[model samples]
Target: MEALIPTPADCEVRSVIKIFNAQSIVPIEIHRQLCRVYGPNVMSKQMVCRWCRQFSAGRQSVHDEKRNGQPSIITDDLVELVREHIMENHRVTIAELSSHVPQISCSLLHEIVMEHLLFRKLCARWVPKQLTPEHKTNAGIVFLHDNARPHTAQRTASLLQEFSWEVFNHPPYSPDLAPSDFHLFLHLKKFLSGERQHFENDREAEMVVTQWFQSQAADFYDTGIQKLVPRYDKCLNFGWDYVEK
Candidate 1:
């Protein structure tokens, strides 16, 4: 298994130890090594060296020392009160709730609702309960894809019917308007275009593709489907004519 990158706290602690123990390893060297391993966006050299200086002066713990501040007013009672307000009216806005819970700030109240109560409001309403894996499989997933022979096999059709999912078919021969053809496969092909290595076997190719797909940001997949909306509208405008890329 790949070792997990040290958390910011752990890295700070480790940097301190490296400073005193090694006595010659510099902050820039440490920063360069960390960036190469973990990517270039981790903590700065200044922070690492600052911690090193503190530790060299005999500071021990890696954990942050407490600073003087007004203690947060939010308590268990306030959290419960916020929960009650949300439960009483699922449609209640955070601004409106702030008026009732004058002690808590709107940001704090929002955090309590989201983090503490584990509730999310969408479009002025509480989000629907999340579906279980079984629910998701049985709740009729609308599968839209290229009409490959395997996908259109009698067994596949029967399975879809049993699961109550309806397959939406695009107009015949309009591959440009087919969401999978125009969006998914197109992007996948482009992504693979820059690769120079040739896979020795199907398993190797599958592993490479799986890793590449997993590395993609969530927005990348969402954007693939989002791109279909305009194509669909254009197809409709052209009276189901073949839409251009």
Candidate 2:
């Protein structure tokens, strides 16, 4: 019989076997070896350690242990089915998606949309979580968010007055006027979509958000703010009528 070549996963199992026999080599050392051959991004350090621990506990199976669930009916085919509808129209609603993929429950479809495809609904429009404080020191600073009591409080108004930061009037039922609603958040949501990274806490999320902001070129933000002008023009033209742009 011809000798069989080992797959990457097979090599990982073999490495684990070697580490077990040696009774001394740590996971970090094996990780270094794998990195030398496959590059650093091949697998996470956490996964390597997990495999090592499993091997130590006499769990010889290289394959994943069977997970307890509804047997994971969400296959790649199902994911592609959902993805096609989303790609055709990024703003497609969950209810609309359910129509196309009737087999998938609303909640499972929601997980596929938010966690797998990296999309979120903002004012009924599908977008990415792409916010950044890049232009903080710029002469013009406009804060636009939903009208809430705390936001309109006297203390908040005083703070804005002190900083000379203008608060754009986000009228009732008008998401188009807000740059965040129509532009910033839409862009942000897209940027974060389909990304596999996860944050353990608020501090990590903040750090990642800040890092994403720092990575953007100045024009990215300039274009977002500039879009507000045309929206403002539309609002004026309609005499403050509900403009859905």
Candidate 3:
């Protein structure tokens, strides 16, 4: 059975152990469950016990800790090489970059790009900055929000009037027309879920969310806002009924 079945990575096995351990499953039971699916050679009982103990002690990451004597893949020359590739084509993907620099893993490459070089993906393209100048100015910016209590409050109305900003009328309970509800929140939820992020405090969560927003390209926001036109048309044509996607 072990010969026919392909082996899973150590990290993969660790992830399974972590999940089961979180549910208070004993190490022996976890190993038994894993053996049933991945064959007996999946992991040793002792290994499962060790990981369960680690998680119980508050270890969050599944990846192995960096061990001494392992040579670092990231070097000045490699950093320069990555920089050259990004400079040549800002749209280059991690997969494409890996083909050019096959010596390093994609995860390591991502670390180099994000942490070492301070580059991030914006609208599917790697960029150094958000590159949205329109945000720097409030000129011709139309503010649109729902008629929530706080939003429709006298203070809010006075603030908008004070700024001389054009406030677009939004009907009640019209989430379809709200860019945040229909678009931003959807992507935000996916990003949060995919990362399985656990924040220690509100500050950490806020920092992560702010970084996410800053990483987005101008076109990402523009695209979301642009959809409001068609959405508005739909709402009006449907006699202001709930616009279901």
Candidate 4:
């Protein structure tokens, strides 16, 4: 038989209180002992004192008493409503959702969006917990390239036009304004530095780079892309001169 590893119980704090109270230790001393073992965050001082009082009053059970009021109800309809709101506006905040669905509490609405719907806030938008292959393929591509011979070639322009991609004009000799130069390469360079050895071939190098890109959170690309607006503004402010960092 495999050995069973003991996991910390949900009522561990209360159990500790019960044990120490039986030993006639004061609440403050009990709290100090708990802090020494479990750190201060395990339970607050006020909670320790409250539990100590409960034990003194002949309360044998460490389990919480059943309350009289109604529990917070989370319906399927409420979950659907939250989903609709999010789909309508991906950048909708929890507070905005609350205004749309005033019946549910903000906390409950958040639970519906995150736990039930499996969506997380990324780049100021509620995105899926995992990006599907379809999601990646469907994402809009905003192409930006410098005025190199190959990039500025007629064939390249024709290909971009065929794909219907919106190309941002890259000012000549302004690598500072390029997101790949200023942001992406800086991080990519650091990542390459930590490699164990040089890649065997171009294929291996491409695989490694693709894996690194996929491993990054959805917000990573968004952050790099969003920097362009501010960078352009700064570049214009500086009269098209090299925009200092």
Candidate 5:
């Protein structure tokens, strides 16, 4: 008797388990290029080629997507938009972003945020002087959060307070908790592909994103909260050095 043969997901996860067991990031361009150039035929030692074949050929149980781009579609404004939506509405998705940005395909919005944006593939953090740790700690923590800042600057603090009741921030390199990493964006990939649908314009995209966000778990904020505690801890323990790449 032989061991039960697993599905494509089993195989893919196994392969990734092997590589990521060691833990590494493969540039998607290199992976996609190998499969695109050599794919329609033949085989090789390239693990990426194998991965591309398994995924693109429908051999894998996981959804197969063919992505090709040396650069990303995300800009500072797009990040700002995603951050704004998540901060205000409690969820953000490709459909929502279509209004903010219409040039991309729905799949791109879904996958691109994970492959590119969340990983800082094209964008970098723009830490404002006001958002720093020192500024944060100086503000009497709770007062800094709700009571203190509003007393100092009622208007500015009020606007911020509206967003904070729902917003949760994750630490750098903590991909597992970020909405783009954990569920929202990935769910969009399954949705757009499974439904064979794509939004044609910004208005349509906004409707889609808004609808998708509404479908998420009420406790969805917990994901970021759990991850952020460690991040905040690391910040306290190491300050600047503890939490950086």
Candidate 6:
């Protein structure tokens, strides 16, 4: 008759003991050698070899040098400059940002703006032209963002709290989770670009955007506008760079 296999709980305890006390009673390697010399035994079914090795840990994680990261070549002032341009001009490219804010590498600027300053917090909210069942859900009905500097300001969050509207920011690079980037921005961009003739200045541009949003029909908003979500996803998948013209 075949020997019954040991239960997982028993196997686990035996495995730990094997690692703790490496000698006597047929150490795993000795068992293997015995199997070769004296042939396989019914008791070999409870071999704790693999589990012992796992528990015998000598830094099981991937080995890599903990080299210091690249030197920080970006400044807070530079990140703040990028934020100001974004607030005023609506967009900027890497090249344009480099031009506007000198004394920083493009890559470093990208890193700092994204990592340290959290420049996305500087912009206005992508106000939904029309709310739907889709707009009904958020992390909280009235919440505030975490991460102090790059998130919504305390005063701004307090204002939103009065109206009891949910406020949240997903983790960085989490484009899939945010609805506004996938919906509101696309609709707003299309509307603004279509009425380009009306925008002679930044103020004019913002006003035109507001007017276009206000003018959206319920059917157009509910149907055609929803398609922007997929396009926004595509843009994120392809590239999230903001190109300045």
Candidate with top lDDT is: 3
Candidate 4 lDDT score at position 53: 72
User: In model 1, which range of ten residues has the least summed lDDT?
Assistant: 126-135
Instruction: Highest TM-score: give the candidate number.
Output: 3
- 201 Cα displacement, candidate 1 (Å): 1.6
The lDDT per prediction is 0.64, 0.65, 0.77, 0.73, 0.44, 0.48
Number of clashing residue pairs, candidate 1: 0
Give the Å shift of residue 38 in candidate 6: 88
Tens digit of per-residue lDDT, candidate 5, span 1-245: 22233233434433452353234444354444334543422222233434544444445343233447755555433444454443333345557767766776777665555543342211122122122232243222221121233333767656657755322343343334333444456667787788887789999978987887788785564453344444445554553243432
Clash count per candidate: 0, 8, 0, 0, 5, 1
Q: Per-residue alpha-carbon lDDT of model 2 for 156-232, expressed as tens digits?
A: 89998899876666655554677667777776777777586688999998897788889889888877766765676
Name the better of 1 and 3 by lDDT. Answer: 3
RMSD in angstroms, all models? 16.2, 17.9, 20.7, 17.6, 21.9, 21.9
Clashing pairs in 6: 93-244
In candidate 3, position 199 carries an lDDT of 100
Worst 10 residues of 5 by lDDT: 121-130
After best superposition, candidate 6 residue 118: deviation in angstroms? 37
Full candidate order by TM-score, most accurate first:
3, 4, 1, 2, 6, 5
lDDT value for model 3: 0.77
Candidate with better TM-score, 1 vs 3? 3
| lDDT of residue 113 for candidate 3 | 90
- Candidate 4: give its CA RMSD in angstroms: 17.6
Off by over 4 Å in 4: 1-141
lDDT of 6 at 176: 40
State the RMSD for candidate 2.
Answer: 17.9
Tens-digit lDDT track for model 1 on 58-169? Answer: 7766654554696656544466577667656768998999999987688998888787666665334543234333234433454665556887789998998998875765
